[model samples]
Target: MKNKPTIAIVAHDAGGLGGMEIHLNEMIMRLKEDYHVTVVASSLQVTDSEGVTFIKIPVIKRPVPIRLILFAIFASIRLLFVKRDILHTTGAIVFNRADFSTVHFCHSGYLKATGGSRVSSGGSFFRKLNSGLASFIARTMERIVYRPGRTKRLLAVSNRVREEVLADFPYMPEQVGYLPNGVDIHKFKSIDDETKKKLRKQYGIPEEGHFLLFMGGDWPRKGLDLVIEAFNQAAERFPDLYLLVVGKGEREMYQKMVSPSFRERVLFTGKQSEPHHWFGMSDIFVFPSSYETFSLVVHEAAAAGMIVISTKVGGVEDLIANQVNGFILNRDRGEIAAALIDILSDVERYRVFGERARARVEQLTWENMHRILIRHYEENDQRLGQKALS
Candidate 1:
């Protein structure tokens, strides 16, 4: 006869292509199973919302800093009337005191890492200004929201992110939780040879060659150019090698980085929604991101039974055991090339690497992540009950 506990999730956007959007969508899906979920977002792309209630928050949609400011103001005002047992939000998007907060990226940490430079410092003037302004706004918001007693608990997506949060809010060490992002293991499992060939044929990828995959947007930060250079070096030894690039970036600009003989081998598939298909047809996954809280794509690639070569960024160290399951490299193109050559030159070794990589990430499922989150929620409830009793 008791009513289900209500949970209100607050974000600027509920669903879309980005990592945070996808995380919000997955969390919403899992929360809806038992809780009466309410989503307060500017725009939502989640489809099956039979049990969820959506409260739209008005936003500017341009000059991103303005959009973030407007959303924070309006969402806070909206939250004043919305009743919920738990107030869940992402980062510092709102001013209201929240029961839970998911910190995906630490703006303050990024500024610290980059020597107080904006992410787009090397970009055009307009881009540099916009990124600088956005970083400033986000850092200011974090200062206000991450203070003691403002948020009951903060869930960081990686250990690195957790450290950064503690670095900024040293007083709230016990309040910060480390939960690495999860991947859908079933959706990205190892495929049979027949299935791999079928996927290659379907995607128009050359079936005769060994494929290496580089997936993600923000080409510069993700080190797509470095991958191209590494692939070029690897290709000199193995002409049957090919690189599959999925996601957003200027293709022509990167194509120039490849030698004329190997340019055609570097296939750019543009933006892909279903990355599992590409993962199925690939043999190796290479990602050289300059920085990350957690690179979900690398984990997904490992789950898909691909020999992974990635930099020691984010929680990648948690997934890969260098030269055992996978190789963790520096940002140097030569090192990436050496890893690629080492993997490609050996058949049995690479197979073992892929299997070990898959085994490592198979346990990191979305279901497990949801369970951990639920545990956090129940722990909060227990604390509240004890406080009330006292």
Candidate 2:
């Protein structure tokens, strides 16, 4: 093997749409500096970088049992052709026992964290069936692919995910590593205040309104219903308050769910090209998701000096301190209302929290996350080397 091992980053999802895609893109851009990185992704429209090579493959979009199994079969065959020392699969994919495999947990733990019953069915028969089947297969695959007998490592994005992995698969605790997802803090910080205002005005938002932004695809999981409810109750108190939702998924369904009185107060800017501007325009970031492995939106919100309000899920607790940077509440409507009211009532406190939130996230840049990921690669490389010698 060469001194700098070849690293293959593979995912079964399209690029730049979801949290997994974001993390994969950030990791690929950063890892290109030191390692020979090649990305094998499902159909996506991403352009290739200088040193990174992206190969497109056909795979099923839905996370169904049969589809995932087929994805694994195709990925295993593809891996056989690629020359790499370590094969890291994000999301969920099983690799041959002969290769060094690392699976990063994003949503697998949320099934347990929120308890199975609270998970949203999203009113789709295929989705419901896929969720149940995926849960079962995930449990079974963890045992078969990451067993102590198999030489592979598991990377969890948060300590919570690490706990979930240990609790679900106790034998693999020693094989797991905790690496949180990071944001491009510089991209957010470099934007001037004038640009932020222009972006807000361009989106039809008033200059002085207290904009509350929610950015995510899974509305039910991210607690958009609760956000709308809380905003409805609090809207009468603060007339200047407005809600901007930036993402696409079941928009018509969610729009029907919103009360007529509150409909005008809320705006849905579907799938933004530049999401950072929405973060900049908003005075506070509100995410009330009941289940999350780790929310990149909260990090992005905090990086843009927006007071973050999220539930205690995944690694959210690590990034936020109640009444310090932002607020953390239960799924209760009353609690969410109270927290929103508190932030809306005290502008000075909100400003203070926003500054603190920005300061807290300054250290969580992509560079820092890449450094930690490289450490994991180096550790794995050394262990593989010693095993080869022994």
Candidate 3:
């Protein structure tokens, strides 16, 4: 019998929170059965990696600049000596070139979009300095590793991301591939009314209100301010409307954004480990994010049978048909408020929206995504005169 080919995946963190970490975890689980998987990360949350080899990349937790630079140096040094048939990584975390690199977010594109002030815009002097330095390091590394031959293939998380990659590196159109993130359909299952009520009570939320969920960290970037203002406006007409804000952001700062009268109706659950339950507890998912490669929560929301109201960012354009399964609105508060009113006005008729949304994302399972990823790996392998590893 022939030995399985070894595959190396490098990242700062894997099998943990956030979209990119979760994507790596999903790929690791599926790839381990057929290949010898080696995960090079600072921290890992995957416990099922029985046959997988773990290479720990020591890094500091605080001060983003130190952490980023340390990981890049150490991880790159380790990659130089590691033996593997294929190499994969998320973004430009290391100095060494990779066989496959997943572009979760285009920092260079973001800098251009936000005029080189995305992270260092409104923070303290030290915060601004740290973020600015971190951004500089990441951009410099990205520029080096995304050159024409630095990577074999660039797996973009969305069509939006694919465009960003091509815009930044127009020379590598053939090397960039559109590979949107997949949702775990089973984990984010729809809940019945009884189950929803029970969950609301468990979370200390009122059981008798129409819930509007705004999830994700980075309150400003995810448009929580828009969601809060819009919810305030919508709450005026629909008295039963309630808002649920999840993820770890500036809670006190955003709580002030809510109208005084409607403040009591809003609840913030700080940083949930399991967000699938939160999706099941809400009726509508609201996101007015300024930018995203692909918001995994939106797909999870739709999978959990929630009417998704979001801006035209990430995979949303591909997932939503206007006024059909969801509403792709602008970042304006009035537009978001109006869309909320339109959907909540007729709950019974609009209930079909969630059903249709679930149906739309039913086929976008991790297993399906894994198959396509393996096919890509094998195709790239064939081009390099390697045996089929699929």
Candidate 4:
């Protein structure tokens, strides 16, 4: 292995406070100890403490077919000039390079999967037009980027993501590796009951109230509406039960979902800078998301020793065992409500599950993730070297 491998990471928006940004930032912070990392991003929204160099370039959110072609051309040219051993693109778009091994980290293929919900800055008409245009652009770009005949590795954040990648691009199975996102267990450990009560008081949450915490950005995809419905159904049984949503998204849309009777019980804390504080105050962590590659919030909740209730979707199955560490229910609202009631009714069982969840998540820290990533980097580098000799 090289003493210090030079690595280049590419993402659409590097600074945005989302799952991708969180993953990238954690990886960058850890990888900088062993590798010289450079980040090439479309938009630079956050600053890194590590001395990794960052290059900002224009990225098209809804580029027409012609503009997308130009974007790939310019991106490839820019990438070629950066002398790096590995070209790691954090999303779906592959980078073409014969000399260096390109790694594509699959986030989502929303453009290819669901082409209808594309949003644009130019308003609704432009957004709808952009969706149609995006499909063509994505298809064209994929063709050019993957046509070089060099087998580039693809990293899937979850098994679901790997299946999606295979379904979308059948010819690249050999290049795909499943790497689920991890959480910082040390930072999210359970607080004492006294501390939890203090935090609840600070947040204006009743000390005895059962607070259901939902943490994520895309409220719709995270099934906030379904969560609201389930909470409403369960409210009659447990009057002190409240739903606390912590993340960034359209507030008006979520507001309309809450009935006037339960309006006081629903609290929107917006995007939290440090979410562990809120997690400390929470009674149970609930995630009813319909779509997710890997739900990091579930892991975070587990680490915090909170009773986790999630839909059996995405990478959750890998981490959560029903009635063991956490409860994973079906997508139906009734099933979710039943699970919530069952857990709430049995305090001893809930504590046992929460403790088990914490034990399971204690192994999934950033330190462990860093080691695994480093191994992948070194192994891939050696494989590339062998290919060169062959």
Model 1 earns a TM-score of: 0.95
For each candidate, give its TM-score against the true structure: 0.95, 0.89, 0.96, 0.84
Error at 291, model 3, angstroms:
0.3
lDDT tens readout by residue for model 4, 1-390: 355667787766564567667777788877666677787776655556456878766756544554455555666678778888787776434355532222233323554433544323233676557656766666555545543254365566777777766776645665666666778787788998899899888878778778899988767667777788888888878888999999877777778888778988899999888799988888798898766677888888998899988987667887899988888887778888888888778766678788998888777777787676666666677754343234
Model 3 alpha-carbon miss at residue 35, Å? 0.3
Stretches of model 4 off by over 4 angstroms after superposition: 1-3, 43-50, 58-73, 98-151, 170-174, 383-390
Tens-digit lDDT track of model 3 for 1-390: 146788899989988888988898898998887788898999888748788899999889879989998998999999898899899888988877778898998889888876667832355889878878888988988888887577878989888888888999745677887677889999998999999999988878888889999888887788888899898889999999999898888788889999999999999889897799899889999999888878899999999999989999888888988788988888899999888888888888888888999999998898998888887787777632243333
Which consecutive 10 residues in model 2 have the weakest lDDT in total? 98-107
lDDT-wise, the better of 3 and 4 is 3
Q: Tens digit of lDDT per residue, candidate 1, span 1-390?
A: 136788899988898878788788788898787777899998878757778999999778889989889888999999999999899998889999998899999999988876777444256788777877888899999999987688889999998888899988754677888777788888888998888988888887776779999999888888998999999999999989999999987778888999999988888888898888998898999999888888989998988999889998888978898888888899999999998888888856678888988888878887888888888887889643333234
Off by over 4 Å in 1: 119-122, 383-390
Model 3: residue 100 alpha-carbon error in angstroms = 0.7
Q: Which 10-residue window of candidate 3 scores lowest in summed lDDT? A: 381-390
How much does candidate 2 score in TM-score?
0.89
